[model samples]
Each structure stands twice: as C-alpha cells, then as structure tokens.
Target: MTDFNRDALGPPAGLVATMRLLLVEDNARLAALVSDGLEQQGFAIDRYESIDGAEHAQTIAQYDLLLVDLGLPDGDGLDLIRAMRRRGNSTPILVLTARGGLDDRVAGLDAGADDYLVKPFQIPELAARCRALLRRPGNALDSVLTAGNIVLVTAERTIRVNGQAIEATPREVALLELLLRRSGHVVAKPALENALYSMEAEVTPNALEAIVSRLRKRLAAAASNVQIKTVHGVGYALFAPPAADE
Candidate 1:
C-alpha cells in the first residue's frame, strides 16, 4: 500500500500491458521458448530449471503469476508447489506438465494452484491462459505499505512520510497506486499511460514529463532515497529497494 500518486497526465495510448511472471521448467529449450513468448505478450518472466530452483525462487523472487512444469530433475514439481503453499505463498501457480489426465490436474489445483496447463500447449494458448489468471482486480487494502520510512494506506487513499500524512491530488494518488502495485519490478511507460489516460484521451509528451516530475518530487519529500527511475526507451519504475552500495 505504498502511497504513490498517478500524474494528472497519462499516455495517449489505451493499453496497459505489464505483468510479472514466474516460470518453472526443467527443459532448457522449452523454458527459453516459453519465457520469450510470454515476454512478447507483455509479461516480465523469471525462469527456474527445477523444483529445487523454484524452491529457492520462492524465497527471493516475487511474481504476479506462475508457470510450473511438474517434471523436475530434482524431484516432483508438485512437491515444490505444495511447499510454497505451506509457506503461505499465494502467488498464482499454473502447472504445465506432460500429464493431461483429469486426476493430475485436479491434484495440482487442489494443492493450491490457481491454474494448470498440459504439455505441448500452444504459445498463444499459454498467453491467453495467463491473462485470464491475472485478470483479478486488486482490492484496496488498509494495511500500511512500508518502504523504509514511507508508508501508504490504500483504504484511506492517504500517504504518509515518516508517519505524517502528506497532501496530494487524486491524480497523484492513482499514479502512486500503480507504482505500489508494480513495485519491486519495472513498469513500462505504455502501461502507465494506459492506466493514467484512457485510449480515448489525448495527451502530449510534455504533459507526461511534468506529471512524473511532480511524482518524483513527492517521493523525494517522503524520503531522499525514493527514486522513480526512467528506463530509456522503456518506462519508469518506482524503486525503493536498497541500493547496491547499501
């Protein structure tokens, strides 16, 4: 619930296309192909080679969606899925195994997976399934979002710096919500544009820059360490994670 305000300005385009995905597979070639195809579909994918790899991924990586292959070199992929659930990881998991039987699919989903895919699936199908799974609208939460000294409360539409509520416009609030939603990962410009301005709304580039500049200032006021980095030819990311030197 990190408080971030959307700029009054948004991109002229209508499509908001950015998602973070986790991919687990043992087949090197297939994993590469799947990762590439999903990336082309506007998803940021993180891949792991085995159940053991996924087990570690569970600790360090955060994902909006998951693609898992049941056959792993180290052990049953199901075991990893089960382990993740046991640890209270609700990141959506979709089994992509060679097993096509109903019982296998049932077992996987019943084990707390959100979706399942059989082997030899088409790329388009995979993309479509992923979109469907990620379609859930996020609920505004009352819990505080703490990135160091910055805190945000989605329920009250309020933002505080070092425990002090700061004033902001509604536009800034929306922009900040998107940043918090996609925090810990890069959020491209096109996606921000769509979220801010509808496809029907027309916007100028200068306006876009002005809005982001305001957001950057607000974040700075919250903490000197806050940064909204611009990725040349890509988009912007509100990254508050510790710097490499730290």
Candidate 2:
C-alpha cells in the first residue's frame, strides 16, 4: 500500500497555473491520496475509476495532463493510452502502476506514455516529473510570458512591471498568464472559466467578473501598458493601448 502518512510536499518550482489533470485509477484510497497530493502542488484533478468514465470526461473538458494506472477494474490502462494516441491526442500521459518490470515500462512508453512511475512513489517526485514534462518546448507552461510592460515568470510564479515585482494572488496570476498567452485575442468566457476553476469548485455566477475586476485594478496600479478589454456580452481580450502620439 502506498504510504499516506507522509507530510504534504511543497509546490514544485515553475508551476505556471493551476493545471487541470485527469487521473484514472481504480483504488479509491489511492485515487484520493493522489488527487489530494497533486492538488496541493497547484493542480486541479478530475478523477475517474474506469476507462468509460475517463473517456466520457475527456469529451467534455480539456485537461493539461493525464495520470493513468495500468491495472483497472474494467480493462487494461494500456489500451486507453493506445487509443488516445491513435486518435491524434498529444496530451502528455504519465503511467502510475504497480507494474515495475522492465518489459512493462517499455510497453508503457511504446504505447505513448511520456513517463512512467511505479506504485508507492513519493508525491514530491511525481509533482517534479509533471513540471518537467510541461517545461518541454511548445508546452503550455513556458518559462516566461510578457505583455507590454508586464512580465510573468511561470517557474518562479512571480509577476513584474518594468522589472519591479508586484504582488498577485494565485488566481490573479492564473488569469494573467492566460491573457498574456493569447494577448490581443478575445478569450471566450467559458474558456476563461475552465482555465481558472476546477470541476469541483463552487464558482458563483459573478466569480469570473470579480476576478477580472481585481486583476484589472492590480494591473492599473502597476502601471502596466497592457490592458484587458471586455468584449461586452462576449468575452475579454488583453492588448497594449495605442500611444497618445500615435
């Protein structure tokens, strides 16, 4: 059995946002432990115990990562991994299972798993591995994101304006990262909601508005050249306003 009495691990360095992860594992205790552990490291986990449930969930929501176990109550997890790859899904997959044999590891990798971790592993190592995968070129968690005078370092989870650091809550930072990534493009409301909240969070109707308002105030106080524009009944966009001389 995996140890459940260990201390909670610290958040990994360079975590960009509250990445959403889908975890497929049958053992109830282990699933809960894994979910709790990853959530503490600044991830939002949506868990399922079977292949059918996992497949259904994916159709409804986009996930940043997939954590799958080889042995499941319904079928082998390898089949699920193989099917996803065949369908052209490139979301990073990390295998978590009791199968520690060399052959099992090779099979998992060949089936398109980016990484494999045997059962009874420490949460800290698992968190570290996830960050490593996200750090790869072209992945979502880029090292740094910039918009006009505002700079955000994903690895350090710090925001700066004109090289001076500014205080921001985690939610504010997450919103800023999303805006900076698609700067000048209108990001739909639903998309922003998904990036900012997890499946289990009880978000009120005006929660998104409230977050946007606070972030706007913070940016203005920092004297950032970039601005967030509400598209009025549609969505929001971030862009630098034209200079007065222009």
Candidate 3:
C-alpha cells in the first residue's frame, strides 16, 4: 500500500485561485489517489489514463502544471514533454514515475521537465514540488498580486486593503486573486470558472455570482478603492475606481 502522507500535506489554505493540473497516469488506483490528494491541497486536477486524452485536453484548455507518468499506454511521457517544448510551450512539467535510476532522472530533465519525483513518494512532497515549479519566474501563478488598494500575498494567503488586513473565505480569496492578477481587463466567465472550481466539482449556475458578490462586499467594507464590475453575460473585471476629481 502506498502511503499518501495526507497529514503532512495538510489542508490547502485556499490562498490563490486554484491551480489547474493535468495528470497523466495509467494506473487507475494511483491516479485517483494523486488527484484526490492534490485537490485537497487546493489544486484542480484533470486526470487522463493515456497521452491521447491529455493531448486532446491541451487543445481546449490550459494547465498551470502537468504531472506525467513515464509509462503510458500509448506513448512515452517524455515524448509529450519534448513535443510541448518543441512547440514553444513553457508550461511547467513534473515527471512522476517508478523509474528512480540516475539516468532516468537526467533524461527527464533533459527532455524539459522542471522537476522529477519517483513514485511511492509522499503526497506532501509532490505538492511542495509542484509549488516550487509554479514559483519559477513567468509561471501563471504568482506569489503576490495587487490592484488599487488591494494587495494579496498568495504564499501567506493574506489580503489587505491599504495595509489593514481583511478576512476572506477560501472562495473569496481564490476569486480575488484571479481578479487582482488581471486587473483592468475583463476575465472571461469560463476562465474564471476553471480557476475557481475543479472539473469534478458540482458548481451551480449562480456559484460564481455568489462568490463575486461576497468579495465585492468585503472590498466595500474595507474601503478599498478597487471595484469588481460584472460585464453581465461576459465576465468580471477588477479595476480602481476613477478619482473623484476626474
């Protein structure tokens, strides 16, 4: 039996918007375990048993990070990684495999994987490794985000308005992080939905609206100069309200 190290990973602090991941593992049992564990740690996971499914998914959606197993049914995971690099895709990839040989690790890295983790490892360590990769410069998930009077520190899961700390629910923090990162531009509704919830989550039609409403109230009560404007049938945009003098 594989030890998941769930206790060590602990509960994810819902600090930033959920990071989406593509997991390519042919072992059904192991795939389920990894996906569930990561989801508990605030990551949205899309699992595929083969390279073909994963390739198809990439065509429609973007993933923050990829967890791939070397032994796939259709092809080698390294091939997929190499293809992604060849096409100029810099999305971070972490190789997860049972092959622990030194040469194997070197090959994985040479093929463009940012990190490699041998199987039968602790889930906490895997989660930490994923965070390390995402922290690398130019990744979609940043450590800190700011807009107008709002400042959010993703690492610490803290948000403040004009230096005064403000409390926010996990969902509120997730929504606020996405909005703050793309401040002044309308973030499409589907994109926001993907960031806020996992594929397996049962989200109501009004789920996003509820989160937006709550975050709006929090900012208002904190006297934030920033505002979240609904585009109605489009999406939401966060921007600083124009100065009174203007």
Candidate 4:
C-alpha cells in the first residue's frame, strides 16, 4: 500500500457531476467502504464482486474510471483490463490488490492499468490516484473545459477569461457549465432547466431564463471571447465569437 503525508481533497462538484466509476473487488466490506468514500467525493460507483460481473456490466454502461482487484473470485483482473484495451476502451483503470511485489506493479502497468495501489491503502490516497488518472491528457474525462479565451476549471468550479479569474453565482456557474459542456451544439431549454434545478425542486417559470441572462452579461463584461447563443424556444450553445470579417 502507498502512504501519503497530506490528506487528499475531494473532487470538485462540477467534475464529480459526470464521473462514473466501476469497482471490481470481491471483499464485500472493503467494496462498501470504498464506494461510500467515493460517493461522498462526488463520484458514482458500481461495484462487482467477481470479474464476470464487471465484464457483463461494462457492456451496458460507460464508466469514467475502473478500480480492479487482481485476486478476483473468478479470474485475474488483468484479463479485464486487457480485454477493455483490446476493444479500444480507454477508461483509466487503477489496480487495487494485495499484490505488492515490484513485478506485480510492473505487470499491472503492462497489462493496461493506469496506476496500482496495494491492499490496506487509505481511501484518500485511492481517490487522489483516481483523480490523477482522469486528468491525464487524451482521456475522455478532463478537469477543465475551454472555449476560446474562456476556461472552466471543473474541479475548482472556477471560470477564467483572458487569464483573469471571475466570480459567478452557483446558478450562473451551473448554466455556463452546461452550455460549455455542449459547446458548438444546441442544449435544449428543458435540459438547461434540469441542469440548474432538481426535478423535485420548485422552480419559477422564468428562473432558468434569469440565470442565463445574468451569465451572458457577465461573460461579455469579462471580455471573454466565447459567447452563449440563445436558440429562442430551443435552448443555447456556447462557442467562440465569429470573426469580425464573417
């Protein structure tokens, strides 16, 4: 197991909103504990006690991360990693097992695991490793979203424009994030409403409209090169402003 001196911080709210993880471990107690810890950090986790179970689950759901134990009840976890890589699944995988030998670590990496953690590891350490993997370049999950001169740091829930940081209300931040995620594509008004407020929450009819309007003005005032385009009854899209010539 790897140890760290400092405690690990939980993932940011915006990053956690979309992350889904698959944890394949046979020990029910450990699985439950790890699942709870990750959930508190804003992750959605699915647990599987055997290699066969995880294999089946992967066919139906997309996961942002995978935590696999080498000593599975049915088969070696490396086989699952190999299979996923063979099928072009690039989701980051972290091996969580009792295998502490140097060769074991090398084998795990060679078998397509992004990082390896031995048994008895701290939950915070595990979570930190997971975060590092997701932030890796070329991975489907990124810690930041960028459009022109505007950058949204998903982990910190902060926005920057032209190298300057800007403060935004929670609602405004949520609205901008939803549009930024679907940049260059239309995000329907209904979807925007859902993103801003929960289904059970009582939302005023014009609540979403108000949030969008405020965010639009803030972005413009900040001189952000990105703009949010309203699609009338449809929705909105975030994108770079058109060239002056166009």
Question: TM-score for all predictions?
Answer: 0.49, 0.52, 0.52, 0.51
lDDT of each: 0.70, 0.82, 0.83, 0.80
**Tens digits of lDDT, candidate 4, 12-103:** 54552446888898888888888888876666778888888888878877788999999988899999899889998899999999999979
lDDT of 3 by residue, 1-246 (tens): 122223334446734456788888989899988989887766778888888888887897788999999999899999999999999999999999999997999999999999999989988688778987777433334677766777898878899999999999877788888887677779999998997776355678889998899888988999998889999999999987654622
Could you arrange the candidates by TM-score from highest to lowest? 3, 2, 4, 1
Off by over 4 Å in 1: 1-17, 136-246
Which whole-number lDDT from 0 to 100 does residue 223 have in model 3? 90
Ranking by lDDT: 3, 2, 4, 1
Pitting candidate 2 against candidate 4, the one with the higher lDDT is: 2
Q: Which residue ranges in model 2 land beyond 4 Å of their true spot?
A: 1-16, 136-246
The 10-residue segment of model 4 with minimum total lDDT is 1-10
What residue pairs clash in candidate 3, if any at all?
none
Candidate 1 lDDT tens digits, 165-197: 887766566667777666555787778777668
Model 3 TM-score? 0.52
- Give per-model CA RMSD: 15.7, 15.5, 15.8, 14.8
Comparing 3 with 4 on TM-score, the higher-scoring candidate is 3
